[model samples]
Target chain A: MYITWMLAEGHTYKQMLPTTPGVFMGEMIVVTVVGADKPGIVAAISSVLAEAKANIVDISMTVLRGFFSMIMVVDISGAVTDLTDLRDRLERKGDEVGVKVMVLHEDVFRYMQKI
Target chain B: MTKYDASELAEIIEMLSFQHLDIRAVTMGINITGALRYDDLGEGVREIVEKHARGLRDAVKEVSSKLGVQIVTKRVAVTPVSVLLDAKAGDLNEAVRLGVSVAEALDSAAADLGVDYVGGYAAFVESGYSLGDRGVMESIPEALSSTERVTAMVNAASTLSGINMDAVYEMGSIVKETANLTGGRGCTRLGVFANAPEGTPFVPGAYHGRGEEDPVINVAVSGPGVIENVVRSLEDADLRTLHDAMKRAAFKVTRLGELVGREVANRLGVKFGSVDLSLAPSPAVGDSVADVLRAMGVEEPGAPGSVLALAVLTDAVKKGGAMATSSVGGLSGAFIPVSEDLGMAEAVRKGSLTLSSLEAMAAVCSTGLDMIVLPGDVEEHVIAAIIGDVMALGIVLDKSLGVRLIPVPGAREGDEVDFGGLLGKAPVMPVGRFSSKALVMRGGVVPPTVSRLMKG
Candidate 1:
């Protein structure tokens, strides 16, 4: 089924729903993780997203100047928790994994980089 | 998903986390003209301002958190109170009393609504003063001293209208009286301007002019530290290359400001006014325009090459910012407030930056003679002459300039006076030894520039 959401600009966007109960739709977010390379870093981050039902649409990982860095574009439409809660959970997970995580809305990138 | 390179993402993060990239102010310009229809002027102003500004702080917070950007201050600017009081007050005393009442209303509403400041307690008397203008001038010391969040400004000169030496002379004493009342702290919230723009987001000079929407969102972008970082990154780069780098950094910063401003306006259901590109600096280290000048190869802020360096920096910022957003207004240049900038205060302490040099630098930059502390015993005519000099520049150059001077009561030259918080602290700078009393005493009007004769 198609579901419509009111965007910040007052425009309506339609998304196809999975017909599963309690699944909702929301905005896109960018999660950036940076720190030293270590074991189970990806697992720890992805596990928190999995718990919140946030889908990782795209991700790129690299090491610059001997420090590990990862960028993930997340679709939080179906997340069980709000952006703030999810950010806190991911930050806590990043702390446990010895990294720094930043959560920002996707529009910050689109508006700043495009045109 | 929207496509952005990982490197671009990293640059954005670095700018925000380390370079002090943020919106300095999101000022909502609200028209309170309709308040005149009510019988009780103060109550009417309170109602209208409260209705408009109620959601400003919350809306700003919401957008700041959603975008992960820091919005430092949420403020409101209303229509000039003098315009509202023109027909309301019958005598000068009534005008002063009514002005204070309205100021109190604005102050209480701002306090309750969580707005940091409310501007537009002002009068525009470039040519001459109406009863309302005189009233606002007389009440300024009292209004500002009594209210915590109210700011006042006077536009006594403009390019087309010439300089109003009478108003300028009056403002000098108004500033002094305000200093006497508030230990010079009240003067910090006051400004005297030439060719004051209508859509400024900065405090003490912001106002909702006649052609503006009833409610609009105007944003001021501050990134002196970000520009300084870009300048420092280029080691031994030529001036041309330095300009290009600063321009590129300014483009990114302006883009961020426009984005945040539009989002906040959209949420508040108000028209987006403009994005000011002024590189406003704070008291914090690394966030100073003077430091940017120093990084540009000048030994100090007021060194020999300082004017050239400042002109280049201001031009590059304007060019890049113009490309980023079409709706640019306000004082879109670098603010060199001595007390508000650590580097500038340091320059004064080191005896490298004098008032004469600062005046020369003001001819090239924006916001003339801002946040400068003068000796308490200095004559009023000296302040008038200083303001008149800056006004002359504005008219001749056809640009916007403002003077915000604080004459600290009982403070001597070279004495450090701390206003604390974002107002910062600076040592009182010495003025000219000789008197300009005769020059200022011949008060009438300085004629408009010869450029006014030119036709389009």
Candidate 2:
């Protein structure tokens, strides 16, 4: 039940990273969220994704140690702007809500895989 | 005669085609010796099983979670319980009691840790036997009938030890009886083998091998979703393009698994086993090995569904894993654990799938007759035949595969084994009612054939 709440609150995601070395066909992005419990965490972040023209492919969310943790898989093939701008905007919102948000290129996963 | 047949000079024209996966589990080793801890005369066996199950659950979760992927199962295969229960083997009732305790401990541990399936309740007697081995094998019917989570395996022969004809003869009857007693779950819970490995992490076939120490870290990676996505992504791409795409994704999946695995191993301080990038499936709405097939534009996953899919998927995964790390092994193909897969389970529940259908899937999969939930009270001889069929395939194909049949207690046709979490809960399927007792009883030795030498 609380899992529902954390998911509802913002979550983490991978923005479609630009297809670079060690990456697959599509642009991939990963987003991660860690913070004190709150509501609409996902709604808030997904709204940002909507603004950035990304599609969600997979998602996982949970609450641990009274902190909300979530991971989102997104496609930025259709994004209107680069993720850096989006990352800046998300950090601003996260700071306002006292939530910690991180936006990573999907290559981070690719980078991780190479090791 | 055509050169292809007579002279054998015709080059084998191979074409890369469909790319999809159906099987999701490649658990190769599960040590069951936890039940034999004799510090207090085996008083700590249950605790050990509990610890083993919990540790596996925790480790599987820690690694999978770190990778941002949903692991389909957190299973453990242990050493056979019979060798350790020699003192208690004579009493079937006592053997059953211990089996029940271990099952309960596993279930309880999984429940507490919020992980899924915990296996490793078995006995192996491929060559000689012990009092405990006989006891555990005898109690299989009752033990399997009573447990919701436990899995079992019996090795009657192997390359190391010549086939135990006597043990094979008895096992045939026992398999059928277990099927009958458990209403057929035993058909899926039971597995017989010639040369079973020591570190298998999957079940119905997992038993402690001599090399296993305490418990070690092993990772089974499933990417049917990834595979399916790749197949769809390359619909218009040529075979080379499709294979390339698969290789690229497989590389990422395996890399992610390696990263997570190394971390878990470092934390546990145990040597890490291979990263099995088996395209495992889930029972979720859209997750299935069959779904993978459908994505390849094949309406069904059957004979003539294109035999090349297996080789293609295998090659792609190997390339990816190779780039990820130098160390890799285990049943690293597509998994098709029947009851554990949502699509197959649902198909069985709907009556569109059958045992032969499973066998067809097994031909190209990592293992055969996996986690198949069957009706209770199935005949044991039938179970023996199922095991024999898979064992024969293993010998003939020279590939590693085993059966993990579950004879759900109190279950009948249409009943479900609700083992929530990674095992995903599956409905029981029906098997042939006729007994294979005569054939099983005639078991001399399934002499190892040259097929067993397949290095692939």
Candidate 3:
């Protein structure tokens, strides 16, 4: 266990509860990564999800000049690991690989009114 | 126990850990009013009890198991018990009994299905009043308190008839009383409507109108963050460019709604309703409709300059939404629902906006008269006047429009009501010091007399 103090509320903090049984299992969600282009980026991240035993439902990649971006929607209900830990690992891996990765909850994406 | 173990679970977890999606809600509509007997209103209610449980029983159980997704909300929508009065006007006793009947049916349905709520105990008096309307309205406070999962609405006024001030006066107090009913739970389940559209899919408010037989489906597509991101990405985009971007964004978003809706219908075995391609904004961060307009260059969203901003955005949004879905029907366009939207409410609270500016926006947007909060003590005639403005717009444009106004008790203009959460906080916007007695006093039914549109 860790005890820590942090600066607060002006920033929105969303607390994700454990997805209920029979609801979130095998759920699918889309993720996107955008940042300066670098080598071995896709391999580094895909391998992380692969190691976590997540299913890659769909994926697309593009190299926008000096920056590289990729969008992937994955199903991870059957994953061998906890989702929170996987998220932490991905953030660290992103730091390692030089590309910023952001995960989006699919249903949240749906409810959001597009401009 | 952990919901899943390794093997398929771990890999799936890893992939979804950084993945994205949300499930808005799962709603069920059950009709219970018919269960009331010709004279035995109570047993007629008992029949409704059996019907909703038996009819929807297998559907809910089967869908939940197969979808492998927990249904977010299990609700019921029933025939408006308010209509019970047409034949039983003298039966205030029966009206009260009927309301109790429907409430018990809702209670039993929720208990049976383990669903949170049921809807469609509603009254639609768009143009004129019926004795049943009055009876139902009178009993709603009692009905709301007595029921579980039984949500209700009264379409007290509409765009065509201007507005019924008497209905306004009654509803104003009724909602206040209803909110106090059952420790505020009733407030969560109730909605008061004006210029209500005929067939909307979501509720506490959805009803299968008597005139509609097709089981029409209308999809409410939402994605404020997506649109905000799109608009944000276009920093220097001109209005034309903005429209183009939104159109492209809408096309992409509509494709998503179409996919899910068709799948839901396929599984449920129902005909598809029109996908309402409304950019219904919510209170989530970065998911604001007003932010898009602000991003469009109206830094102060409620200022005089913003009216033009709204006009341009409303028109451009329609242009995009029309291009996205062929079945762009229902109240389609951007929703400026104050209580439901984060940015608009914030703008009002900060004095960046006013009711006048909101009404101006509605003139060109989809929801002609929408979720605006007026101050308490504003006369019924003033409310009627606003409704008149909305109805005029609807008649002139030949579109479906509605209003969901809340007059918070004891709140005045420049004061704010904290609804908390996604209902957001509302700033009581100013309604002009004016009256429409002359216009409203001349109240006759505005017949369905669209000469050219009817010709087609």
RMSD of each: 5.7, 12.0, 10.5
User: Which is superior by TM-score, 2 or 3?
Assistant: 3
Chain B TM-score for the candidates in order: 0.99, 0.75, 0.76
- TM-score for candidate 1, please give it: 0.93
Per-residue C-alpha lDDT of model 3 across residues B1-456, encoded as one tens digit per residue: 122222223222222222111223333333444654456665575455445444344554444333222233334444566665565457667566656665665566567766555556677666667666766777777877886666677775554554455565566566667655543346555665655564454455565555543333335566555566667779998878877776766665555455444545555565555555666665665667778778777886667666666666666656666665565544556777776677887887777777677777776677654556667666655655566566556555655555556666577887767666556666777887667667655655555435334546
Q: Which parts of model 2 are misplaced by more than 4 Å?
A: A1-115, B1-39, B46-77, B87-117, B145-148, B157-194, B345-353, B371-378, B406-438, B451-456
Model 3: which docking level applies? incorrect
Ranked candidates, highest TM-score first: 1, 3, 2
lDDT of 3 by residue, A1-115 (tens): 0001100211111112234532333476555666775676767777777677665544556543235567665566767776656666777898888877665444423322332
Tell me the tens digit of each residue's lDDT in model 2 across A1-115: 4234434433233332223532334566666666776786666777777777766555566553345566665676677777667777777777777777766555434443334
The candidate with the higher TM-score, 1 or 3, is 1
On a 0 to 1 TM-score scale, where does candidate 2 land against the true structure?
A: 0.67
Q: How accurate is candidate 1 locally (lDDT)?
A: 0.88
Between prediction 1 and prediction 3, the one with superior DockQ is 1
iRMS of candidate 1, one decimal?
Answer: 5.3
Model 1 per-residue lDDT tens digits across residues B51-162: 9878898899889878888999989999999998897999999899999999999999999999999999999999999888988999999999999999999999999989
